[model samples]
Target: MTDRIQEFFRQRRAEGRDLGPCLVVDLDVIRDNYGAFAKALPDTRVFYAVKANPQPAVLDLLARLGSCFDTASVVEIQQVLATGCTPDRVSFGNTIKKERDIARAYELGIRLFAVDSEAEVEKIARAAPGSKVFCRILCDGAGAEWPLSRKFGCVPELAVGVLEHAHRLGLVAYGISFHVGSQQRNPRMWDGALKSSAAIFRDLAERGIHLSMVNLGGGFPTKYLRDVPAVKAYGQSIFRSLRKHFGNRIPETIIEPGRGMVGNAGVIEAEVVLISKKSADDQVKWVYLDIGKFNGLAETMDEMIRYPIRTAVDGDEMEPCVIAGPTCDSVDVLYEKQPYLLPVSLEIGAKVLIEGTGAYTTTYSAVEFNGFPPLETHVI
Candidate 1:
């Protein structure tokens, strides 16, 4: 474990704390990350995706930082509003909101919304008349950790039709939006999405519809098991793409960063419950933790999201072990196919820390499953 993490736990233990499964968020790191994005994209508006970490402290801090919010549900909208942020600064980024929720958002003074289909556009038109809406175009999701495969966005042609339909329905079809998917590593992914967006812009202009904005949607990456480029690099790529595709006519830009803004600021501390071999002559050592997939680490689906893990035990030699979560579900195994290395001296009751888990853990945890409580959280 890193000295800082060890010292954090050491201090807690010195105060006679129970070292159970808990998520620790460093607010300072989140602040620094917000500053980095602001500096990287000077004139762009940031709508921090609240689905990343809905913790009150996280939302309050971002609101105090003068950041807008990208809310997905009515509850999220209420949460952002409770922080004293106006609804105008919020975007209903989810394209799947119900008609009642749409009307509720509009009643709350939110004018910005996202749409991906004709049905959604019609619903928004009736529920939130004259609202400013953006159409989401499908993405290839290349080099992204979480590739959205036709689950949310539409084809460019379909998006163009959707926006036109919105305009006909007395709604302001302001711009286009697309997600390169979460934890995107390749900057070229934005290039293609931007070029496609530009094509849509031209098509709309040909029809005498002038748009004012373009939402890049969040896909910014954070460092984890693999190295990721700096926010500045992503900024450069995005600006270059905008310049290349839209030229001097680039519209107002917006970013809705969720993982990139908070992923690295969160860490989960768990305890080892058991260590043993599954069978005789088995070369693999199995280590079980108190936390698992349903508890909070649901992002480990298919082991695609790998978190950097460390044990409190210190040793000169390390051995690989299959980590599992303490759940009745057999699928609670965290790293069975890909063994994680830990000190051979690791034992039951040792604490393990999982780094870079701030974004998806809490929001995705089961409320109460397998008799395990929801993941506990602490902010620093």
Candidate 2:
């Protein structure tokens, strides 16, 4: 760890007081990140994915930073609009199926949406006739960590048929969109997404159809205690491939990055309530902590797993300790292995301030079975 981080941790611990398990969003960090990302794409426009964090402050910051939004639901759209962003600047990027949702977005003057199937197109045609739309094409299943080929997005082979359906319905099929899944380490992964989009656009052009926009869906990760692809480098790299395939004369290039935007801006502060030692063997000891799979680090498809932890908010020095969460279930664990601070000792009332929780930390915990109230969040 850097000396500055260590000093920050030490200073906070010395001045530490009492606060409940709360989440803190460093708005300054968010603005700084926004500025950096914005300066990188000097010519192109950006659409921040609202699904990532959706803090109104974050949305307002994004608008002020000169980025639009990629909203999934009417609630998200309304949230963005409430931030004073025009619907034209916002794209309802998720696949629209329900008539009520579609009708609401159209009623609110939302123009562009993602179409994955004929059924969705038919629904949109009936619900919001003439509303401009984008067809989401399937990514070639090569480099995505979570390849969306099987579940959502239209298959490349079926692009013509879908576009033809849109034309037949007299709908303004305005563009195409594709997601290369999340935390994409390989910029080359976008090569497939770019190729698929260009191929479909060309085929559609052959059929005398033209599109005006292209939404490259968001998954850019914020470098929170780790470095992968810097957004600037990734954006430039993606743009190069994009220009190569579609040339300079193409539709508006839109990228929706969610986690890449606000993930580094927040951390969750939790009070340690209990500590217990589990003995798998004499040499194997697991230290249980107060936080668990619920309040933080809960985004697991099936089982809860802790990511490699870094510096805590308050660490005088480094020590080896295992962290676990406070829940009735045995799965309420923060780390199963590795070294966290032991604080020279363990006490019940001590705290753990976890970083990189800006995405899905608070109300992100959705469970009614345990009868737990939602987490309280405060921004700083």
Candidate 3:
């Protein structure tokens, strides 16, 4: 956890404020992150991904920074609009959108959209005529913490056909986009994706269609339990890849960042509901918390993602414990497969602050499941 986070929790505890399962966002950190990315990629346009942490405060701040928005739904588009952002600054980034949602986005003045298949291209053509569309080409999602595979993005050939169909159907074939996946760690992975994009641009040029934009969908990494390279490193690698692939013919570049921008800016404060030892001989203690998978930490599925947790319990000795949620569901277990150690003196009513939770927590939480209220977010 960052020093600011530790200090924030310390001050909250000093003030005796209720921190019950609340997701706290530090807007100043978010602003610094945005500024860092903007400085690193001076030539690239940033459209903050709305699906990460769509807190109105986040959107409002980015809007004031002159950042565009990458919205995945009509509600997200409306949220960006409510921040007084111009329609052209919002890109309907979801490739698989409902027809009515497309119409509504168009009605609200969203001109840029993302599409992956010919059918979706046709849907956009019919629903939002003359709209500019970008085709999402498939990537292997290598070196990414969250592999967004099989659900979105099409093969390059399919994407080419989709762009062709979009042009034939009277919609503007504006650009090509691809996601390297969420929490992408290896910056070299951009090489192949950019090469494929270059090939598509050449193919489109052969067909007398000159695409003028390239949307590098979000895969930027954030500091979690593991360390990642600095944002400047990612920018340097991307610029090198663009030069290697497109040379001087590079199109207008855009990056859609979700977790990379907000993951470290937030933390979740939860209370220990109970501690149980299955039997007298049981070595692993079950530490139950008020927040769990169904509540706001579903990213722990299969133990792929781990959040750094801190506790107020003070001691020199620590012991490995099994952390589980308060839910009765068997799958609510958080760290049974992985080692999670807390102070040996930790007990019920102790507050545990989970870091690197800003982006995925509130957005992915279930609403009022298991008689517990949904995760509440507090932006500072």
Candidate 4:
């Protein structure tokens, strides 16, 4: 956490206004993260994934930094455009889209689209004729914290047919794309996907359709309870894999970073609601916070992402505790399977700081769940 955020909480407490869980995002951190990504992949373009965090201030900052956008919906596209970014800099990255949305995006000057099936290609060709379309292939999401497999991409062979159908239907078969997974910690994971992409490139070239680009989909991770590699490490590994797989002719490339772009730039401050035990003989105490899965900590689902939580009594004696949220839902518990270690002196009304939460919290927050308002956000 930054000093500015600490001061914000201090002032709020001084005014007796630190009443609810809120997220504070530091724009300076985002600016530095953008510069790091740009430097790491100098030859490749950076497309900020709007689904990660679509705050207006975040969008405006990235736009001014000369970053393109990967939007999942028309509303996200509009949010990016509201920052004065041209439609040419935005890609409709979602494969499963309504034909009407494709038409709408085309009307809005979006010429780049993602596809995984011939049906999708046909829709795009009919809606946005001659637009650039890239086919996504499936990758076994090995070594990723939150694996993104099975739902989005087609097989490599199917991708070829989809792109070929797009070519026949008057669409520009642009290139190949694959996501290694989200929060992938292994830098070497890009090698296998790049190898598949190279094979697709060669197969299409033999059929007289030469591709020009490869969308190296985002898997870059942000620091959490466990440390992750630096962006430069991923960049070097990816560059080396590109040379090994597609020698002499590295196609024009781009990266879509969501978590790595903004996950570390934000922090959440939550108040301890209650501290209790289930039974008289129970050794573990249940510590409930004002924030929960429905509010701002949805990433804790399946215990995949364990955020680093800090409190004023962190330096005191510690013990394992069952952490939960202040909700009536039975599944609101965050650390039941793997209990979190916290100070034994932690009590009700204590304020805790959750770090590395800049990307997904605000966007995932629910509105009026349990009569609790959405996660309030302040961009500094």
The C-alpha lDDT values of all candidates are 0.90, 0.69, 0.89, 0.93
lDDT of 4 by residue, 86-129 (tens): 99999999999999999999999999999999999999999999
- For candidate 1, the lDDT comes to 0.90
Clashing residue pairs found in predicted model 2 = 218-256, 290-326, 291-325, 291-326, 292-325
Winning candidate number (TM-score): 4
Model 2, range 239-274, lDDT digits (tens) per residue? 788888899775687888777777777665566676
Q: List the residue pairs that clash in candidate 4.
A: none
What are the per-model C-alpha RMSD values against the true structure?
1.5, 3.8, 1.7, 0.8
lDDT of 4 at 57: 95
Query: On residues 44-93, what C-alpha lDDT tens digit does candidate 1 reach at each position?
Result: 99999999998999999999999999999999999999999988899999
Q: Predictions ranked by lDDT, top down?
A: 4, 1, 3, 2
* Estimated TM-score for each candidate: 0.97, 0.86, 0.96, 0.99
lDDT, residue 204, candidate 2: 84
Find the candidate with the highest lDDT and give its number. Answer: 4
Judge candidate 2 at residue 71 and give its lDDT: 84
CA displacement after TM-score superposition, residue 197 of candidate 1 (Å): 0.4
Comparison by TM-score, 2 against 3, better one: 3
